[model samples]
Target chain A: MTVLEMRDVVKDYRLRNGLRSTRLRAVDEVSFTLEPGRTVALVGQSGSGKSTIAKLLMQLERPSSGEILVDGEPMPYRGARAAAYRKAVQMVFQDPFGSLNPYHTIGHHLARPVRLHHPAFSRRQVAERVLDLLRRVRLDPDFADRKPHELSGGQRQRVAIARALAPEPAILVADEPVSMLDVSIRLGVLNLLATLQREENLGVLYITHDLATARHFSDEIMVLYQGSVVEHGPADEVILNPQHEYTQLLADAAPAPERRLARHRQPTLAAREGGGQQPLG
Target chain B: METTTQGTTQGSAQSSPQGSTEAAAPSATAERRPVTRKRRLFPPMTLKLGVGLSIAGLIVLFGLIGPLVVGDPSTVRDIGLTGPGHGFLLGTTQTGQDIFAQLAYATRGSLIIGVVVGAITLLLSSFFGLVGAFVGGWVDEAFSLLTNIMLVIPGLPLVIVISSYVPNKSIWLVAAVLAITSWAGSARVLRGFTLSVRSRDYVLAARIGGEKRWRILLVEILPNLIPLLASQVVFAVIFAILGEAGLSFLGLGASGSFTWGTMLYFAQNGLSLRLGAWWWFAPPGLLIALFGAALSLINFSIDEIINPKLRSQTRAERNRWGMSREQRQAAAEVTV
Candidate 1:
């Protein structure tokens, strides 16, 4: 069953220059469906509108024109409906370092979302639940006492995950969850996320610029470019046999192990550096 | 790995890291020796507590304790006019009150006016500023217009005019008037800060997290503003103190109250300074300088704490004083 659906969504942001000089179509005519207990990755380049789609899905930015249905119900933009919608749909941001408040301890950060959503939980119960969440995310429960700055990058990301899960959200919108992590710990975080998704049966809309991780982490993939989806299919199919020219370009650009090894085996580093590199017009 | 995890869990069960939820969290640093010292220390609570404590301590000592220990500050004495004696520790005024007593009691009034005016100004400025910046469009334009009007008008002159018109205005009343007029600059600053914060992802998160606008402003954005707002408040208080003293020195403040400015005004009027009665004028002048210095020192300390670059430099300086190369490297690595 489709847990979340967006139909023909479009977002246009007005530039600071008073004339509405530059109209940035962040998300244009983008449509996708997220099924229950499935992970869908949105892959793209820096300005490929992948993050914009996540923002649209999370209602961080309202689409200029579109329909968003959550669990076969039309999501309202304000008041009671909006509150309910927000509770059901939570986000884990890309930059773990930038995501959590540096001022608050991990316990404080986790407790807030939980308490806000489920006000009925007694203080003691909430405390227990927070520990469970910390443990689930692979963070030592004791780390909750430490502030965001006290934790390593990977630990902080785990806290972010725990915070997102505090509400027991059915759909988790993880925007580049492991992008800013250390290369060594990046796989661990991804594995932890996949573990949580499977255990909780969460519908995850994972946004990233890395296709390699996307292939491992997601069940399906959507390649976004210039405010639109260029290609969409099963994750392996899209990664292995990219259909669109843009998808192929994205695949080629991704720094896969094979590419790195091949580059190392080249006759001369400088000569091989420029080879097979396509210019964007 | 299992044993390490179990050990971490066991250690966590002992005390639990600071405020962690479960008992399974490590107590301090036993979890496979995870890099636990990575946190920054410039949180809002520390900032608030530090500033609040300094303000409280200063007020209690100078304003409350000093006055209680010394005799009535308003009365003047001529005996110990520059000659130190057993009774007059800081000497005596031309009219013969204890200079020490007067200086101490005067702190109460000066600090009161400063705090009241500064707090009022901060509230007004932050409120209008956030409203203007966050709620943009017509509201911003209207507030900008108001700010511009306040900006262009000569503040000191306006205060002189306003104060002169009123009959025997008390310090608090005068402070209220000053607070009313002085909020424009702060409002402009806070508005700019809020405008920037409004674009941040956390602010966006708060909005989507079902937090009301007021909560977002107060809880999220306002907390971040402490480091900046704190210094702003100190500066405002200093200005307020100066303004109150200036008015009193000019004989425009509360006629009944005996503040440093009042003493100065009286001493000048009585021709005490010219007559070599340095006790009266010097006490108040020195008091003003002392208060200014204390506030400046505290502000400097706060600035060091807030700005990581400064904090790191300070750490480096301390390291230079004592730390070994290996110790410094370990500290650096631990932080990462």
Candidate 2:
């Protein structure tokens, strides 16, 4: 069991233009805790530093200040402890197309993480584990031999999810896992993720710009605006009664069927001019 | 269900129709698998590649097998400066040496130089280029500086200067000189490519997956660069052969060895041009040019693998007279 905690994390990028150099704060001081078996959705528009937070948690980028603690211990930078840290936490990238290596087969992608985490496993065991992971993601085992290009966007994202699950991670940081997928398949992938999260009891950090899925899929919602968290509460409360103006704006941005139906009750200019508006119940 | 359709403005109607269409997508892809597998098993062999390979193959076979069957090139005979006739297949040199035998041995020697230099260049360039760019910072800066310095230096002058200092230059010595002078350009190319690949999301994912730096560089990055590396190596081989020929023509080539360059050197010394002994010089010169052109054509084909735009350009050129729709589709299928 592991509890991942970000205690006031900040990330700054040094931007240089010719001779002048400026510091851009990509992620301001933000804090959150991810307990096992719970999903925390980091909701924000693009450039709101949601990905920076994910990167910082993945240890791809070091925090400018503050510390990320894993189960009360500060994150290790290198050596055995760091490797163990990697085994506990895994990520699914946004772009399924860009996240996978084109030259490698899907089996290679899954087998690598399994092999890394379980060095004692024989070659046969590793191969078996790879096939098992594919099945767990509801994919045909034949997909193990196929390269990433052979798979559709939804299928590739499923493979990415399986890869994150291969190491049997305690926490999964999914960075816009389904955004690049087609709209029709998004729910299927998300439901797959929610099912996996429940089965594995893995703490999840679901990062996205979509507020509805954030509310539906996550237990808690943390609205990030300009690298800072403006609102953080239970998912329903955040959606139902947004405390921050930014959170209200985000909630308003998502189309509400009720709101549309109410608008339809009062005839709109286009509806009046077109004179062909369908009646709504 | 409401959450899923948020990306699209179509609202509730979007999901069902798209969902039905997506169900067919999997079966469609299942049918495509065997075709892709077949394509992979037998990649479409382009005309340029076939022509180049055949020409190169014939030349290589001649070089390898010719020396074994031919008589001694050094054997002196009474009949000197003869043309292609009377059992002398290519003719006689100024000293009655068998020009055919000399050409055989010379082709073999030049090929050996090209292969050796090519191997050396591949090692040196990949080290300085791929390694440096993958491991950036001061190391990259230092390597880039060294590569830039090497790139700026004139190859022929440097080779000439190095060759002049050595009293008895062997074939290996000439090959080494050419390799050292020629690798910088390929190194720069590899470095630029490595820089771009290093930052790709897959590489980052590998790093986050706890992959060691060396493994990431080797397994993740190296395979993608294979086509580029092959193109560079072919270019290197061409350069080595041509550079060795130039050095030998200038009377600074490997001594006591038979190469196309040495054959040309001896022919030039004997005034084969003035004496109209075309057999003495023409075969070796023509062989050098043919070999270079064949390798270049092969290089262009390899370049198409690295930059797919070149493949499309060639296809467009092939269909310049205007192909029918079915013909174009067939062409596309073949290429695909």
Candidate 3:
């Protein structure tokens, strides 16, 4: 019942020059579905239409020609219906710093969703709910009164996750949620998302370009290259034995620890063999 | 890589209270800030704020209670052009109207018109500017066109002509004239602000979060525009009061009321300046200047608070860690 499906969605942008128009396809005949309790990773590099897919699912932008279905029903078109649908499907944006309003306190951010979803809840109930959400995100309740500027990256991302979770959304579309974070903390945020997905039975569409995290975190991986899905299957099949050439290129690009060490050693070895200052590459 | 690293550190700093955020920020900022922290009377209050509060407090005090303590401004209770006598502390006008009472009552009219016009202009400008920028395309084109059309046209001449055409004008009518003419400038500025602010990721996030347009405008957009709005109101007040005085001096003021504009009008008509009777017009003129200064100071103070680029260099920063402050001072001395 909680399946979110994209059916052959096509999105095009019309570039205009003195009334002459040309179309550029951003997402070309793309199709996928996110099922409850499963994590679907949309993997691609920048401008490969990974985020455009996320935007399309969030209904921030419309598909030029395609169908998006929520449990076999067409996505809501009008404002009221869209708002109601939003309560069931929420988003955690890429940049946590930019996504959360700076002027508001953490309490304010957490309270808004609860208040919107449960209008019948008393003020005390809403307060407790905010604390509960903060707790769920592994944040201190005292952090609620602080502004967005007072929180760390991981903490802010956690708050953002908590906000997305506040409405008890069955589907969560997180677009590059950890790419901007420090390398050290990225795993912790990914693990939190994975844990939340399992606990809530949420359909998580985790959008990212980093295939390493995608392999470790996602149940299924969909490799997107230049707006088309080049590869899609179980995470292991996609990463360990990539079927498409583009997916192979991406896999090759992701440097493993041993590969990085070998690469670093080669440069020094090359330097020893009169390759010093030989353009470093 | 640097941007992402710095962003992570800043983000952690915000979340962590006084950790890596400060550790990173201080190194970048410490050299620039030589002035060390000291005990401040009002820690948050800026210099302009204190000065503005004092002046504004006086203006309000006069507007509220000054008239109540004086006799009626209209009553011709003394001989024409008489000095302070018979309890008339500010002497009498050419027509024997009490100058003190006139100044007090005039404060009310001038303030009333200025405040109302400020409110009206701010409303119109904010609505046009924010709505246009937020919902761009044809709506923005239309708004920009209207604003540009109004801006290029001479505002005062337009106000004068429009005011002249209206028969039996009141203070509110004068305010309306000022508002209609003056809102163009603020709308243009606000449109620029709104354009930049509307693109901030939080605003987009709020929109995608299912918050309605009005709520996004009010909650997300409006708080960011407070300083701009405050500055606009300050400008609007200055123009409204000045406009009032100009129109009234031109004999377009409400006939029944004694506004500052009318007071100046009467003073000019009676040749008070030529006759060496300074009491007639100087007080209202001085009050206008005082009000202008007060609002300007408040605007200046707020600018530093809201706009980081304009913040004062001599900030009170505590030299907590080492003799870096002393070392910087020595380095500055060496440079000098």
Candidate achieving the largest TM-score? 2
In terms of lDDT, the poorest run of 10 residues in model 3 chain B is B34-43
- Over 4 Å off, model 1: A18-20, A255-281, B1-60, B69-101, B131-141, B311-336
lDDT of 3 by residue, B155-225 (tens): 88888788788888887888888899899999999999999989877887676667788899899898878
Please report, as a residue range, the 10-residue window in candidate 2 chain A with the lowest summed lDDT: A272-281
TM-score of chain A of each: 0.89, 0.94, 0.91
Error of 2 at A78 (Å): 1.0
Question: Model 1 over residues A61-144: C-alpha lDDT tens digits?
Answer: 778888888777877888787777788788888888777776667898888888888889999988998899998987788877
For model 1 chain B, where is the 10-residue window of minimal lDDT?
B36-45
TM-score, each model?
A: 0.82, 0.90, 0.85
Task: For candidate 2, write residues A1-281 as lDDT tens digits.
Answer: 99999999989999999999999998889999998999999999999999999999888899999899989999998989899888899999999999899989999999999999999999999999999999999999999999898899999999999999999999999999999999999999999999999999999999999999999999999999999999999999999999899988888879889878766676675477686654331
The segments of candidate 2 whose C-alpha lies over 4 angstroms from its true place after superposition are A267-281, B1-43, B315-336
Cand. 3 TM to true fold:
0.85
Error of 3 at B197 (Å): 3.1
A22 in model 3: Cα distance from truth in Å? Answer: 3.2
Error of 1 at A167 (Å): 1.3
Clashing residue pairs, backbone N/CA/C < 3 A, model 2: none
TM-score, model 2 to reference: 0.90
Give me the runs in candidate 3 sitting further than 4 Å from their true place. Answer: A79-81, A260-281, B1-43, B83-87, B313-336
Q: How would the docking of model 1 be graded?
A: acceptable
lDDT of 2 by residue, B55-128 (tens): 99999999999999999889999988988996899889888999999999999999999999999999999999
For candidate 3, lDDT tens digit of each residue in A15-75? 9988899988899999999998888999988998998898888878999998999789899
